[model samples]
Target: MDIETCLDSRIIHIKSDIELIDVKGQFISLAAPIRLTGQLRLTDDLRQILACIDNEVEKLTLQIGVDEAGRGPLLGSVNVAAAILPSAWSGLIEMQTLVNTPLSILTDSKQLSEKKRDKLYPLVQQNALGYVVAEIPAAVIDQINILQATMLGMRLCTEALLVAVAEQIANDTSSTSYNLQAQVLFDGNRCPELDYLKLSSFGISESSIDCQAWVKGDARHTSIAAASILAKVSRDQTMYHLDSLHPQYSIAKHKGYPTRVHMEAIKMYGVLPEHRRSFAPVRRVLENK
Candidate 1:
């Protein structure tokens, strides 16, 4: 259901009182919406999406969720974050709607279409608060291993939020600083550092490391979805910017991930400074070409 939900250029909407009988059934407005499957499926409209979201948010008043994106891809970085809402959650939703984004599609990061991401990138940027993203360069990934890299990235994102919230509060930059806290909810059980570094690294700081990993975090977790959007938009923008330097390779097309376009670029141009020679495909290309 989360996978199929549209997030690119289509705003999902259902009436306040309309009872959603099924996907194909009428989206007739009613007095009170019937909640089914913990999610509502309906048309693409701002008010409708907001209502559905509000229904979800209203149920889970206080909780933090975490998720990751861009892991399978060979290029760019692994991105993740932990998020919890303040009293401003409603305002955040309203601000998301008011961001002049008609096709404001918010869903799991990879679920979004390329066109939709390009369109709503700015909106996500405009609306997100206490957002964090970590760019795990190829070198670090090679050294630490992918699993550890992923965990490290998530940890960094959480720390980033803590840092930002602390910064804002210290300087009184804005009202969002008060909401920052150490509590976190991750999507999986195993932490790379927890297994790798264990409690040894935390020392006295163990109490500050409060997070739990879940099974299908990005799908069911709102904070994870929020993190997913933050990471997705950030990495996409990075790809767009890098496209300028590697125009012939079409970095923007593959977004630094290994694709036919990227492979061909490697074969044609050899390795550039940013190319991850540590990757087998990149190494093979160098060996063969």
Candidate 2:
């Protein structure tokens, strides 16, 4: 039998044989003798193994992940994504494997190429239990500063997703309770204030939801990674559309980042309505002009 190494190092696929390997690299034969002995039959699929692993660890409640893209750009809106993934690690792992995109390869949007992020975008949306992508435009960023704008975007997406999830549960015929327990993870050191959600009309309680700001959570958590991909791809598409309208700015090339080409374009053509006046580079151009 030929051994095949999956893109994810955890999963090893064997060709022409029915043996299964666990994450710990322990091999279990799924052939006749094992079955006759009444030993547990395991599938070659990593999801089954992951399920077993999940059970061994603590079972978590609903997980909500929030992340943003285009926060540092001198132009365009900041896009924030709130995503709810399956609480089980197995289910999260399944999302990537289904698209043939390994978890290790697609851990964070920053580390992924544009092609890979585009490929995973739709798959993430389809798999999410609930999701919301909110944009805070440059005008708003200028009004409240970039940090506040980013926080606002995060808050908006999180609120929208929470409401959507609450509505789904309320409408479910089989569910008896309106109470929901969830863990909200934000991909940064500081999360937006959600204390107001305690008095929300959706019957969601502050005590029931735990919000945390996890530094580099995008790489550590599957739900956050999915959110990052969605936000990145959405922002990229926005830049592409803007580029089509204003080819001189090369928005698509740098996605409105303060590159030499972008700065030169701003200097020659002047600032667009989309440019953030609060940003130093764009502000300097405006001052000089």
Candidate 3:
């Protein structure tokens, strides 16, 4: 069901002796629910529901979050990042405590200042079980278009991170076997197809994969916010490096956005190799040149 539908569903009050039924008709017995009052409190509720499902499979889940940056930029690569957060808990109380920490302060990368994102960059990496950042360059974006390239980048980031996590587990256990579950979340209205992903190859259960596209997920989910920070910081760092090499473009000022200064730079200094020729602003400039 969609978020609206899920929100419209009746809120259940958990009691030690009473049984609660979820939307899927699953009967769950809870001593108490993690009651955090807010519209976004549903995030905690969803985590509890997923925990219930994970209990049925008897597997520890890895929450994988994916987000992207620079998709709308007129130059440079679109960077995507995937972050993995472990969901190992003794009980619902422990799980609630783990998730309700300072991490909840994280929000969309665009909403944060550059200084804040830079500060959180290392913190996110340190907290995550594993993460991978992938980029689709402007040239490749020109070949396949921004949307397809973004999907491809996100897929690559998720695949690479999963493989890395699996490898780490195998090294720690001295065996290439595991029963990890994955709950993959994307920070947008639509996610790339996950059905074709080879769960077995990653030592995860095929049926245990719960891939969802959550709108405004960066604001609601800590994992998605962490991924957004990585992507945004990485892309911004790239732009800064590019600026150092070519100061005339003023890439560091606008970060390749189609702003008045950026457009004027393109018209005056002409298109660079990193400029997205497929974009209308750069295309118009190139056509005139």
245-280, model 1: which lDDT tens digit per residue?
A: 779889877877788878777788777755656678
Which residue window of length 10 is worst by lDDT in model 2? 32-41
Q: Please say which candidate is ahead in lDDT: 2 or 3.
A: 2
Candidates' lDDT values, in order? 0.49, 0.66, 0.65
Write the residue-wise lDDT of candidate 2 on 22-137 in tens digits.
Answer: 22244433211100000011222312222323113322256778899988999998888877654443234335532443333556899888888888887776555556776667
State which candidate has the highest lDDT.
2
* Candidate 3 to truth, TM: 0.72
- Stretches off by above 4 angstroms in model 2 are 1-60, 90-105, 173-177, 195-199
Q: Which stretches of candidate 3 lie over 4 Å from their true place?
A: 1-58, 86-104, 174-177, 194-199
Displacement of residue 17 (Cα, Å) in model 3 is: 55
Residue-level lDDT for 187 in candidate 1: 63
Clash counts per candidate, in order, are: 14, 0, 0
| By lDDT: ranked, best first | 2, 3, 1
TM-score between candidate 1 and the true structure = 0.59
- Consecutive 10-residue window with the lowest summed lDDT within model 1: 34-43
